[model samples]
Target: MTQKISPNNYLITVANDRYANSTQLFRAAAMIHEVIHAYYHSVVDDNNSPTTNLSLNNFPALYQAYAQKTYPYGVTVAQHDQMATDYVVSMAMALQEYYYNNNPTPYPFLSYEVFTDLA
Candidate 1:
């Protein structure tokens, strides 16, 4: 969840208590999901206005952009849709990089299959 305290500050929270038992990859992905929600909060509702700021006329270049599409579905649905489509690869890449960086080892076949405990 996201809470905006000011123009430039936002509180983005992920439930560690709820997700601590999950795999590292899943926990990492959950963080990316929450961060994207903060992005949505900033881009779509920074001012807390009742009307959407993400329109073709007002924000033409951003209207259909990957992280900025909120047309027929409004802000809520569109944010999730955009995140699901655009950030899945991001989540996987981040998790993969994390595995490689901390372990300092190449993926056996460049796949998570190399991590036995990832299950």
Candidate 2:
């Protein structure tokens, strides 16, 4: 969520409390979701009248296909549906890399199947 700080500025804050005691996997997923939100905001947010493109909010090619498929009325799904379908393996791999970096002895490998059940 966003809080309007002033006419020319906005503040977006992630509540780390939400991830307190959460596993690294979930933490990574949350981070990815927020990142997608940030990207969407960057692309579409234009003053008070946000502009969406023919490419489904002008999302890059990587996101355009699935976004066009799932965007309601060619608007947006808040990028969640596309994120779910496209970034699962990425999130899992990120988690694995993070764990390995923290503890190299125990390779924390995971398959994309770990996230297939989500959504």
Q: Top model by TM-score, which number?
A: 1
The numbered model that scores best in lDDT is 1
What lDDT does each candidate get? 0.61, 0.57
Give the per-residue lDDT of model 2 (tens digit) for 1-119: 54445433456676778868887667665665666666555543433233433444334553556556667445356366556677767766665566557655666565656644331
Stretches of candidate 1 off by over 4 Å are 45-74, 104-119
Count clashes in each candidate, considering only residues at least 3 apart in sequence or on different chains.
Answer: 0, 0
Q: Return the clash pairs for model 2, or none.
A: none
**Model 1, poorest ten-residue lDDT window?**
110-119
Distance from true location, Cα of 107 in model 2, Å: 4.9
> 7, model 1: CA deviation in Å?
2.0
What's the TM-score of each model vs. the native?
0.57, 0.52
Model 1, position 56, has a per-residue lDDT of: 45
Candidate 2: regions farther than 4 A off: 1-12, 46-78, 107-112, 115-119
The Cα error of candidate 2 at residue 36, in Å, is 1.2
